[model samples]
Target: MNDTVVPGRGDKGLLRNRVVEVENLTIRFGDFTAVDGVSFSVRKGEIFGFLGANGAGKTTTIRMLCGLLAPTSGVVRVGGLDFDDGGNGIKSIVGYMSQKFTLYDDLTVGENLDFAAGLRKLPAAAAEKRRAELFGMTGFDRPLTAKVSDLPGGIKQELALAAAMLHDPEIVFLDEPTSGVSPAARARFWGLIRRITAVGKTVIVTTHYMDEAEQCGRIALMRAGRIIALGSPDELKDSAFPGPMAEVDFQGSDPAAPIERLRKAPGLLALSPHGMRWHAAFSEGALMDAALSALPVSVRVRKIKPSLEDVFIRLAGGAQ
Candidate 1:
């Protein structure tokens, strides 16, 4: 279905009052190009995701957007300000939370917040007010004097996010925010993300987790420093496989034999084992039915919806 369009290839009209705009963005170090002419725009107050495996240039892109790293060539605009103009003032209106926790572990939670506020150069009175508001919203019931090093993993993540948003920036950048957290912690963290976006703050996050990618308003799948696909979760899934998908369970001695046999067929686009069953995609209509009939009658087949993982595998041409 050719879902591998360049980033922001088709959805230009839908992007109104964009909070971030990048055109022909490229970054290079010596001879290696980390980002290659990527183009995409992020809408205001929406969650934009960069979905890909490690070393796919997600962190590099985010760093460029946050003004920490300079792009070799491109047009980048954030909050109606040009990135080429040094982007010094842009730092005040944009918040960034890196993959690793950046706060001082030796200090108390309150002290960490104070340090962050100082870095932002906020006045003491304004910083106090913001601290009160953040603590209230985050339900930071732990003693402000408690050392950050002593907090639980989930609490540490929450505290990191709180520090990022202490200044109430209009735009937020979260780089792999849930890298080592548990599923329950991830869920709770995402809930916080939802509430933050609900209040009119734009969010740009990078993650390899498919479930987390599904939560974004839109996602751009990156591969080898390039965007191969971009769309909402449903749109990507629909365009990923232009055929019928089915989950099959074979009541046979060797599932491998049946899968290997099916691979040689003309209509089969992809076939892969899922536990005791197999998930396959085939050309629509007659071809699909024909492929199904070729399987042994002892097999059980049921049509199923394609998942994001399936879509990625098919688009990446790694189907098996």
Candidate 2:
């Protein structure tokens, strides 16, 4: 992804009839303010991606939205229900999967499902039927008699998700659902997310992965309890780093020398090392020729699209 920042018009009524509406949400603990005056909305059936660095208030905002915590001063509405009126109604309509795997490791898969069902006050027969459906959906044919601890990481996550959604909530809040899972397992988990959205369930997820943010229908970039940027992937890229980017790699020398040289080159707006290579963004026709000409004979360079990581770095004033 290119780090180009595209200019954005203020938020419009794009999500006017929002399923989840937050207005000037703020949360504070004693003298420390966790979430500032942040406001955003999630439309029905939309996959909304919440993004931020550590301590950026992403979790605080989520907690407030889920009715797990009340904002110091702000209005929040979930599924058109007022959050402060009574949390019970809201809780019943929303499902949540925290970052930590919250299943009882000692309990069998069936037992876990049953426990969740019982908490939701589901009928015995209904809970049994739902358990079978969940197993089929997650591709877990293992006996429900097997303990949760006996399952692999991927299966554990799947079962957790199934449990969270057992009551068929209208909205699901997933807090870094793929945090510790393997790449393949992450992909499978995303598949389940798609399936949920296909059935008209709104998914509000928070993630630190730039690639994962790109998969969302729209995203909000947060910092210190405030939203720094919010828009589609392309919009944010275009606004944050409004230029072409080139990714350069060398066969011999370190990227530092080329990076420093590129910084002084004309038309090059930004240069930073990403892993073993260097990424440089340039205004159109600025340093395209000069940068290429200045590279060492042992170096190789190629132009690539800007990414979310680049945009975030630039917006945050190069603070990785």
Candidate 1 lDDT over residue span 250-300, tens digit each: 866577777788788777878877778888888775787777788888899
In terms of TM-score, how similar is model 1 to the real structure? 0.91
Regions of model 2 farther than 4 Å from truth: 1-17, 254-257, 317-320
lDDT of model 1 at position 30: 97
* Model 2 lDDT, residue 301, Cα: 77
Question: Estimated TM-score per prediction?
Answer: 0.91, 0.90
| True-vs-predicted CA distance for residue 94, candidate 1, Å | 1.0
lDDT of each: 0.84, 0.83
Number of the top candidate by TM-score? 1
Which regions in candidate 1 have their CA more than 4 angstroms from the true location?
1-15, 317-320
Give the worst 10-residue stretch by lDDT in candidate 1: 1-10
The RMSD of every model to the true structure, in order and in angstroms, is 4.3, 5.4
Residue 164 displacement in candidate 1 (angstroms)? 0.6
